[model samples]
Target: METLCNNFPSKLTFGHDAKRTLLVGAFALGTYQGVKLTGNFLAGVWKHLLRPGYDLKKRYASDSSECWAVVTGAAMGIGKEYAKQLGRRGFNILAIDKDESEMEKTQAELSRLGIKVKTIIWDFGKISNAESYEAFEKELKNATNGLDIGILVNNAAEFQQESLDMISVDRLFRASSVNSLTPALLARYFIPKMLARYNNGLKSAIINVGTNAAEIQNPRYKFAVYGASKAYLHILSSGMREVWGDKIDIMTAIPRQTKTPMCPVDYCFTATPRAHVNAILSQLGHESETYGTMTHDIEYYMRFGMFGGFVIDNMIQWLNEGESKKLISAYERRMS
Candidate 1:
């Protein structure tokens, strides 16, 4: 560094003496043989070691770097988009679907991105015979070596055109199960393990895909039965956000009628599922988070993507010390 400091004037004497003093200060008494390093060299080495990509930093160590993201309904539509984007970001993907063929197709897609892919054929619409937690725990074992799930996206859903009066009790339950109940079960199934991992201090995220119908209150797009089911999902998600601590991020995105299978032919053109995928990928795991919007359509206009994050974050911080009611009240108040 003295040689590197050639441009300094006859402060050369000061530099030389300072280097000698630091060199002497390095060892308890004196220099080790003739090879002595100045304190400046030690500070430089410390800074370099802490810098990004340094081997000593361990930023990319297997323990820190591997991410396992599991997405439901990932065979196509928004879920498929989530899987591809996450895989492209180097996350190993575990995708699930009732359709074995589509699961296989996503496996191929993830593979092409050089991401290790695992396909689990399970129907979230039906509760597992085993408890939901055990079922997911079992699936996690089949997917990865341990319990470090980086993210979970609940996206599997079905839509119908039938009116509430025309829909049967069983049929309503079926649609409800696909859109709401399964997500709750998957949350119950995944949250304990997620919390445990987070308590042990892991970085993880949970994304619940909600619908704009939940925001509109008794709207008529997908179906009345389905809309009411999604309304239940909104309350349930807010409750989960309450329990998942700050270290673990939990968010529900409400995208409107989209060019996706979740909506029937009538609603596709108004919403673009792919564009919403970009909006969501931009929001996830980004320390800058967004929150409290009943609809993703409104989220598009938020400048503080990081704002409202604390709405949930504060709840997790004090462990049941916060409420989504405040957020809900504010959003609803704005409507009038």
Candidate 2:
């Protein structure tokens, strides 16, 4: 009884000290995380909101009108806006797409901007074939002869919104070609030209359009294959930047939901094509990879933060459910 009484106070003090230490450590950890998030948020505001973009006209010497910007999928959506914006900045535009009528419209708009505009109606899906790709390369060279190609925008992509097993092999192949192979091959073709331009005291840039879905660490539910293809694109962009970033301005513009034909709904976070393109262009020469908009930057941080996986998973599930309902309703209406 004497021994127990003698040791009780010391043992009690040790337990109390341990609990207090744990509490202090947890508080310190929470404070560090909070500070990190706050710093990141403030930096994003400065980058996307306050900071001025690099001057394209000054950088490319717009007075000459010899610099050209080639844009794929330039008939509509984000690609169309990129063509318009680059043309407005005095870069001649080479617009490529499968839709002849749409491309004609885009060409007309670009011509009205007083910049040279050329449209090529080629099926991106066809470029999967070796001979077709070689032919396309020859066409590109012929079309841009006597022009300084300053920018190449790889913006064409096939969006697949189905489960992996449900998607057709042809569809997946086409997506891989458009989202993965096309950008890689186009970069290979353009890097030499851009480097040559660099040797001649000119600057060039390549912008590869990617998807935010590819950045998620978890497997995307309905768009796994699509995400995987875009992930390959993201990696390719990074590698190219590592190699040629100093010589040429190379960047990957990753956008989330946007108001385009592929995603028609105007959600709260969805940016218009013009807004998204403007944000992306503004970030050029500053960042190797960008989310393309302030809204998207926030969304990216939130989705990847601690406790973000649970929320994002639920949100994706809800969106998938909503999509299924829409498809079912359309089917029923057709049957009726």
Candidate 3:
């Protein structure tokens, strides 16, 4: 009985020690995560709020008229907004798109900004056709001749919201061409020129517009091709930054849903094209990769970080399913 009493007190003491150890471990982990999250939050605040964007005018020569800002997919939506904003900022604009009439309209709008506006009507979807690409190259060279191009915005992309089986081979090829090949080739063609200008003491920048869908860790249901292609662009931009970031400012702008013809939804979180472009422009040289707007950043963390993978995955599936229903309904109505 005496030995049993002594052993019971020892067991109780050991249990107490184990509980204490667990509590300490949990506290330490919580504190570490808290610190990490706090640091990230403050860094974001600094990048988005405190830091001012680089003076883009300084990128030009003494004669700003010689400098040009090249923007692809510039006929409408975010690309058009980028062209307008860049033109307003004193840079002559070279708007490239497949739609001639839309390009003409964009040119008219930009011309009112009093900056020189030029258009190149070349379809990026024809990237697989060697002869077509060569023709586009010639046209681009001719258009940019005698002009000091300072900025390149690779904003052209083909969005396909279909499952793998539903996606047509032609569309797959076109998406690969437009979403991946065009940006890669454009950067390859322009980087040397940009480097030459940079060597001559001119600043240069490249903004490769990507999508938030690329960053999601979960399976992107109908966005297999689109997401992967944009992911390629994002990584390409990162690689370019590694190689040429010192001389030229290279950034990837990843925006969420914005109110555009491509994505016509006007949810509370959806950004306007002008506002989205403004947010992206404000972060140039400040961030290598950005969500483009504060709302998107918040949404990203909430969906991916706080809500976890299961929630986000289901949410995405639901949204994509809803979009699929709308598309099917529209097609049926057209047929009827």
Candidate 4:
């Protein structure tokens, strides 16, 4: 057997037929993988983009008479849009935010839709601390009184791009409070009510607004406690879905560039607040996790699907670093 192996011909001595056959097999394997990837990509496109998505009215059985929707960070950006859309969908709104004036405006706008609008002015950024937590809980309890909450949108967040030494311990803690702790507390407070409502034949949903960066480990976003906090929320939502079973709908929407005050206004693949929130609402019960926009869905498959996390992380890091530099310049101009 050893002698036969040693006597095997080298590639140079192979017959034309053998070489052609080997080449054909290699091409066939490559073609198979290419076809598989293409099929997966197309299927994802059909599900996320082309699909009509979940029908909110049908999900709630067309009865939103006494249902209330709670939206954190409801003053501006995607959060504000969530409040408005839900209000339009016939759900009364409880808008929670740090900005009293902005929330007042939101309340007025939502009120015009003939839906009750309750504004709760409190700083979620301080929610992790005992003193602030107690105060927030008190406010939440009062705000939720006599209300049957059918949906909870955890859209509040804090974001900073500072290196370890540059970011204060206080800042880190606040980011954690806003992005992670507040969502957990809010869900804990409202989920039981949602479940009770569900048992009464009312459907409920929880949407944890997440970030694409949370799914990828990019060192450039190392200073982003925002991503880390969102990652915690992402995993928490996944577990909550399992724990709640069919009692309530749970989703974690990981969006890419959304044109918000916190993010660059003209970034590539950026979606308007209305567009972003629409995508999120459409995909709510249909998917436990989604990119939240067609552009984000395409970007996700192209980046994560084709190159995996490492290259995707580097791409994100490159974008983040550029945005950070722009932020620094803008800050310097403001200071000067």
Task: Compute each candidate's TM-score over C-alphas.
Answer: 0.62, 0.88, 0.88, 0.85
- lDDT tens readout by residue for model 4, 309-334: 56764666576666667765554464
Q: Candidate 4, which segments miss by more than 4 Å at Cα?
A: 1-25, 61-64, 217-222, 307-321, 328-336
Candidate 4: the clashing residue pairs are none
> What Cα-based lDDT does every candidate model obtain?
0.61, 0.82, 0.82, 0.79
lDDT of 4 at 65: 58
Residue 6 local lDDT, model 4: 84
Cα displacement (angstroms), candidate 2, residue 246, comes to: 0.9
Better candidate number, 1 or 4, judged by TM-score: 4
For model 3, give the 10-residue run with minimal summed lDDT: 327-336
What local lDDT score does residue 138 receive in model 2, on the 0 to 100 scale? 90
Question: How many angstroms is residue 34 displaced in model 2 relative to the true structure, after the best TM-score fit?
Answer: 2.0
Q: In candidate 4, residue 284 scores what lDDT?
A: 80
> The CA-based lDDT of model 2 is what?
0.82
- Residue 11 alpha-carbon offset, candidate 1, angstroms: 93
Candidates ranked, most accurate by lDDT first: 3, 2, 4, 1
Residue-level lDDT of model 1, residues 219-299, one tens digit each, is 343246666777777778777767664665676777664655543233222456666665565555432223211243233
